[model samples]
Target: MRSSSRLKRAALPRSAPATSAGGSKTDGNHGLIAGTAAKRRTKKEADDAQGPSKPAPKKRRKVIPVKEPEPAASGSEASTQTSHADTKQPEQHLPSLPLDVLYEIFSVLDPHGLIQLTHTCKYLCTVLASRKLDWAWKVARKNSPGLETWDPPKDMSEMRWASLVADTSCSNCGAGGVTSVDFRLRMHLCEQCSKDGLIHSSRLAKAYPDLLPIVRELVPYTNKKLHSNKKSDKYFWIDDLQSMDKKIRKLQAEDPSAVDDFCKERRDLVKSILGRASYLRQWHARYMESRVDFRMDQIAGRFQAIGYQFEDLDNPKFYLHPLVRLDTPLTDAEFAEMREVLQPVLAQIKQQRTKAERSSKVLELYDQYKKTLLPIQRIYVPDDGNFLWKYPKFSALLTRDTSLEITDAEWAEATDALPTYLSRFIEAKRDKHIALMHDRYPAPDAMEFITLAASPQALQHAREETMPHFAGPLELAIATFTHREDTVVRYNRLFTGRELCNSWFEKVKFQFADRESGLVAQMVRMAGLNPRSTTATEMDDLGAQFFCRTCHNTDHERAKAAQEPHTLWACSWRGLLDHFRGSHPTAIKIGLVNHEFYTLERTHNVIDIFENWCCNHCSEEAVAFLPRQAADDHLQAAHGVLTPSVGRDVFFRPPALNVMAPHGIQSYYQFKDSIPPQASLSTKEPSPTS
Candidate 1:
């Protein structure tokens, strides 16, 4: 059975797809186990007992054919009615499977396995294909348990809802590994089915005006596009298509006078549950992200206990393990058991890795003979390339291999070739990484691009992500993570990191350059602030799209009240960047980058950058703007040096307006209550600007 199961899994991806319980083919969707989508389930999760790691189907371009009416030859109405009665059953085999017993057995089977069972014969297929049999799958889903939450649409039938949990295939088409379910549409389909089968409710309404009233009464306008300028999309709920069709048909049976009342009641019910499913879906998504973050921190702590130090806890290695992602959270004893299971595999990998390193070094010397000495010295050997490591003439450097021992004459020749190889190898490697251009250096703004690039989420970035909507710090984290460029020089200093990729090397070249259009667009559309302070160009020239928009009109601000906040956006990315640098001070630092790297709020001339500068010795702005030497002297004389600064410009922009911290820099979680209280430092002394 174990071998059979292995064969089934191995053959699943390449072979013809298995059919669904309703006798539909689920194909072209079987590949790649769910990675992050796998979560820490508990022991109670029966659906995950066999550990399929139930992957979402691989996205591809298979078409979704329109569903046709049920065939008369598919099943007999007489058998369906009389099978539940005392005389006879519709099933030819499995005579003892009372409906309840059948459900009990099927409850343990996932959708994929249950579908396969139904395909055994036409009798088994007909027996399982009726509406009454839907309860069996429903019971199966309810009995199943896991970290994943499946909330079916309000109008969907029980069997359809159960299919999402019991099987990993499309009921309509038999697409395998179909984890991406849409409750609003009432189906778990592969990507193409989603695009092809489901039409927007608005589009449907326009096409069929006669049925428009019924569709509008049941469906709602929702799921806004990520773009702020686009209209809200409409969707018709079709999870329980039979039930929806039944309801629509019942109106035809009603008295003409009573039909209006029935329609009104239906509309009211839909409105009551209108966004309920959407709300739950959104909540689940947010919960999953936070849970992944929490689990990663726990893993980092566990590694720290075993002697690994991780300065950046958010690093991908901590959170992305295959077993960690797929398995349920184990109790202490279970974790110990799992650890024992993995120890041998880990040891073998480590041993092979060590030998491979030694083997590579040995091969490098032979490679150098071909690359360097062969052209000049005409070095020759009897064996083929890679002979040195494959058929060693001397003992393996890292292992005991008696056969590798050679004669004294061979040793002498080997020694002659090795001396010059080391220097040349080191030089070659250094040359690859050291040479960098001016455009390759990174500045602060590149963090967002870096984070998205480094993350697993980067795979869908172009299709799904909209960078203009991200907050400053989140964007910076992404950029810092993914960008890898070798930068030799910057404004005045130099960039040391070779983290930014080459493609971005070109983009960052003109990123903060004077009056770049891309930067202007980001400032106006993304950061929600104007760059008027830095750029001389107006919003119109950069294209009015580079400003805050309401209904696609970026011509001017949407009219409101004077007391209300501004809706208009600015045109200069650098202008807003400079404005943040000047007015908000540590906002971009606290918001975009960590505070450990920032020294102080850079002053313009001889003035306090932000108004909140308070001193331990003097509770005024006078000490805040003074040169470092003067601040130390005031603290030493007035405050008795009890509170001393290194005279290394570490002063902060203390909060005003009876606040906890500065407004934009509120994310500085490390510094709460650490700021000094207001006091007098110097007696209004004069100081020179540095």
Candidate 2:
């Protein structure tokens, strides 16, 4: 049967290929081929009856003739035209989108984004301003974060409402930084604009006396309160008042009877405005607050992205910066611009905080060391008190790359090294003192100077010469041991080492006493008394007075000019030594003044001697003069010093001496008992004298 079908298909004279229901060729179906062949024959007969077929003609399309662009008269015009063409081409495509598609795109944006879109081109502004797009604005407002709860006022358009709330600019001047809105006036005003455009209620009467009462009643007002407790002044929009006034005047001119009706309508309008403004005001406040919060979050994210910790965001230095506190969102480009300035400031703040934390930790460790380790360490080495940390090596050991904790092993290491550090510190201090002394008093040979310093007499002489002029070992030790690198060191507290400083002080006092003894002996010998046996008290009782030959001769003119006792400069035993050591560093020749002459000079020149005394401890310039009792009281109260010494702590001022008459030589014992001695006058007047 297959062979018969194939022969039949071949005999069909290659009929048109028959297709299956699915439109595939069916070579094996003989019935389909027969049907296809019969239909082709019928189509050929129909074509022959209808004759030749022809193609239908195409419909003509209307051609739009475009004018060729004119050649520019200038390069600027050509460039302007080119730019306009470029911008116009892109702008044309955007508006070519379907109205529904544009609405859908705008509806997804917030009011701020929608407002920004309007600023891009005039086409967008016109389309967005159309009443047809009003639904799109409403959708945007509804989708916005903080504006969802509030609707535009009845009299306000959605665009105007969005601008009033979202635009950060003064409506009148168009200046930026106006984050707040005045809903009552339907505008945003900067601080300066608010001051200039809003009329205070008190000022309204002066500015427009005739319209004040009606304007105050009809126009919605804002309370201008500068302070919390102050009484707020009612501020009306100047533009509102002018417009209301013109309307009222026009109604009176056109229809006098309707004037009242117009006022009543305005009153109702104002009521509505005020009611709507209240809700809008609350909405604006929430909006601004949310914007500020969003901006702050953006700032924190930017900082965190740059490797700052979450806790670092809470630092006032970061949060209070003007950039972080802005009510506008931070953009990546803005962060890039501000990073140069902000990164350094943030780094400085972080460094300061780290230093403070490290200092606090070191202080805590020091406190523990002082209470526990110090007492045990003091048994081996002299106590440095609070000055132990002043040593650079010791401080480095305590603070060198240490963590917050001080382990027992670390403490043990420090304890073991304390004696060596203390020894080094002492050696350095001794070397410093010697170097300073050698620098201050340069010698021809350094070895010879050291050899001389070791001798008792040479050392005493050196001390007498240099101690009054230069800082001694004790002063140098205090300065070096208590010095701080960060701040000026206050020498309010005394620094004393129990074994070390006390022994040095004792040596200083002994050396000073030995120098004073030599001077006292010279004075006793000048009084013609035995230098070995004559006590200081007996010499004072004798009223032994001495005069400097050099001062008597050289200072005669100065004494005369000062109106001082120019007959001869008389001095007591202590005054003689002070004058010789201070004024006459070279060998000074002195002779004892006759007792009668000395008494007479004292009687004439010692005017208010007790009143001219000064406290050496308080007065560095020796200009603070006080009476005997007042000086004693001041010493006790101010310095906690009792029984101040005469020549050492309190001295007679030189200007207190008056010119005296000359005297003849007489026996020293004759007038010794003539002057009844007082303890304060025991040190004779060193005034302009030797």
- lDDT against the true structure, per candidate, is 0.37, 0.53
lDDT of 1 by residue, 1-690 (tens): 001111122211211112345635322211111211242233326555646786534644333343453444435885555445423333333543344465577767644345566656444444455444555555544543432355445544444444433445654556675544443443445554444444456565454444535645654433432222444565443333224445666766765577677778767756655546566556545544554455455555664577543433333332455544422223466556645654454444445555665566566555544343211011112112333432333234536432243445664565454434333332332233323221232222221222112343542341133222111121221121112233422111111111122122122331222222223334443323343221212221232212112211222123223333222222222233334433443323111212332223322222223443323323243655454456656767775664443211123232211111111211111211332111100112111110
* Model 2: residues with Cα > 4 Å off, grouped in runs: 1-80, 87-94, 130-145, 150-158, 200-213, 225-232, 249-262, 268-287, 367-690
Give the backbone clash total of model 2.
0
Instruction: Please report, as a residue range, the 10-residue window in candidate 2 with the lowest summed lDDT.
Output: 1-10
For each candidate in turn, the TM-score is: 0.31, 0.43
Total clashing pairs for each candidate: 35, 0
Q: How much is 212 displaced in model 1, in angstroms?
A: 3.5
Q: Name the candidate that leads on lDDT.
A: 2
Candidate 1 Cα misplacement greater than 4 A, ranges: 1-91, 95-104, 110-112, 115-139, 147-158, 201-206, 220-231, 235-253, 257-261, 272-274, 279-352, 355-690
How far in Å is the alpha carbon of 74 misplaced in model 2? 10
